[model samples]
Target: MGYGITLQVSGDYALFTRPEMKGERVSYDVMTPSAARGILEAILWKPAIKWIVDRITVLNRIDFESIRRNEVGSKIPPRNVTAAMGGAHVDLHQYPSEDRQQRASLVLRNVAYLIDAHFEMNPSKVGETDTPEKFYNMFLRRARQGQCFHNPYLGCREFAARFQLIDHTEQRLASHYADIEEMDLGWMLWDIEYGEERGKGKTMYSFQPKFYRTMMRNGVIEVSREVGL
Candidate 1:
């Protein structure tokens, strides 16, 4: 069976349990669309169904610290690796062809800014009551205004610098890998359901590492630097 994975924004999330840092790393889910389309293709075998993504929901916008402490370990490599390669380690076990394709999926490599104006809740006046409906609405509003930029071959740090999103302090957020299972993003959910099919042939996919290579060159040279090699 042919396959493809896509990511979409889910909803707004509070970055931290504490008040001051609550809105820090706030971002979106970025997930795969519905299975209905894929299912239809499986049943009907239609070529036209190829390369279609269903939807993108905004799960939550969380704090940067949480992203670092939680996701960095597993999602990325150790500091030594980063220092040596200027990116995550490359696992040679992946499907070289698929790995190459993923490098071009802008959505996967791009850095997305949590558009605070659309997603962050307005501070309540002195003694106003808050409700779930109000909170959910806030997320929806932010989803409408959410924005992201894709750097097909660049790491998070370089991508952020190129786009002027943050100074060095926020630089780590680009490569920090955290445990996003609780967030219910496509990667986490699919891992639980399909047992991580992507990893079946390889220990890990190659997108992140390839992105690293692109970043190290200061955005000058890319994997596909040659005209059509």
Candidate 2:
């Protein structure tokens, strides 16, 4: 375990698209662990350190709303992009007009969550000067000053999130459904696990998503980092 921190995130809308659902987007009942990790990385991230979500606390009532959104159906191929970068003549652009489609999505509305997470140092990537405290302080400073590499979003880029670092020494806010004894949330996305290097320099890896059974007790979901298929 490394240094840990808590973040209070809120947004008007969030769309954590389910992996099984295609064409139409349907969000999960609550924020996903992967999304929470993304939010933390948006604030401060380094190759030497990796973020981990311990748990998440629902601060608002779970609610959903339906909306149709315009999205591009096709993306430029990676080969085309690489060829263009190498000065080869290649079509490396997406024609939104040709691929635009409106898809119905069920998304969360007026969402708020408290993310409890920590980061662990990657030995191979860590530098001589890199220390756990250094990264921890860096995250704290960036978070306190409202600085991020990019705008931290809830589940999607459009749904920008507002974040506040919960100073561990200060009083914490209460969960909205604290009165409830328990609630079953079923399976939820944890994060992605990448396979070992497929080539020299370890430049390429395979992507695989992991999910875990989740149960929310008193609006708080305790995540077991151990997740699998």
Candidate 3:
């Protein structure tokens, strides 16, 4: 059996950008499995351990709000930066006034979730000193002490998230959707399967996006290896 931990995360605003909407930003009804894993990794992560999200519990009612914000239209080309670093003159600076564009976003407000997750030893990264129990204890210590490599955010970096450990023996806090029996979330982005590089020092890597049909029953989304996109 794998060791697991429960983290209670809450944020003021969240934008889980929907892939279909290219122009404007739209958020999913709930947190995706990948986002849950990200939060756990932020709290405590090591190359030897890979986080697996077991389930997510929605603790707040889904509320959406729209707002307009200025964003950059495009990013600076990497080639231009590389050339400039090599003493080749290239215009790499992008003035916000010229690139700024206003866009509306439909985002979730006052969101909270309880993420249940576990860690598995990465076969390639594991060493003689690495053990599941050792990493598990380290995660617990860091989480309880409010320590992290970086502050975890809710979908977007601008929206900060706060997290705490949940005790299993204690009664779980009630969810706003407790009265609702169930709901279908349609097809949602599951996670990106990153293609591994075969040779050393090779810059060949592929990112394949995956999706899954999500159904929430009594405010919980269960994730298992058997459930595939």
Using lDDT as the measure, the top candidate is 2
Q: How far is candidate 1 from the true structure (C-alpha RMSD, Å)?
A: 21.9
Question: For model 2, how does the per-residue alpha-carbon lDDT over 108-165 read when each residue is reduced to its tens digit?
Answer: 9999999999999999999999999999999999999999999999788999999999
| lDDT of candidate 1 over 66-144, digit per residue (tens) | 2332122122335455465656555524344443321111222222321111112234431255533454343334323
Clashing pairs in 3: none
Off by over 4 Å in 1: 1-130, 146-229
Deviation from native of the Cα of residue 157 in model 2, angstroms: 0.5
Candidate 3 deviant stretches above 4 angstroms:
81-92, 197-202, 226-228
Clash count of each predicted structure: 29, 0, 0
Q: Cα lDDT of model 1 overall?
A: 0.25
RMSD of 3: 2.2
Positional deviation of residue 162's Cα in model 2 after best superposition, in angstroms: 0.5
Q: CA shift at 115, candidate 2, in angstroms?
A: 0.7
Task: Give me candidate 2's TM-score against the actual structure.
Answer: 0.93
- Residue-level lDDT of model 3, residues 1-229, one tens digit each, is 4798889999999988889999999999999888888889888879998888988889999999999989999999988997998899899889999899999999999999999888888999999988888999999899999999999988988888999998788678877777778889988888999987767755677998888888888888877655455
Query: Which consecutive 10 residues in model 3 have the weakest lDDT in total?
Result: 220-229
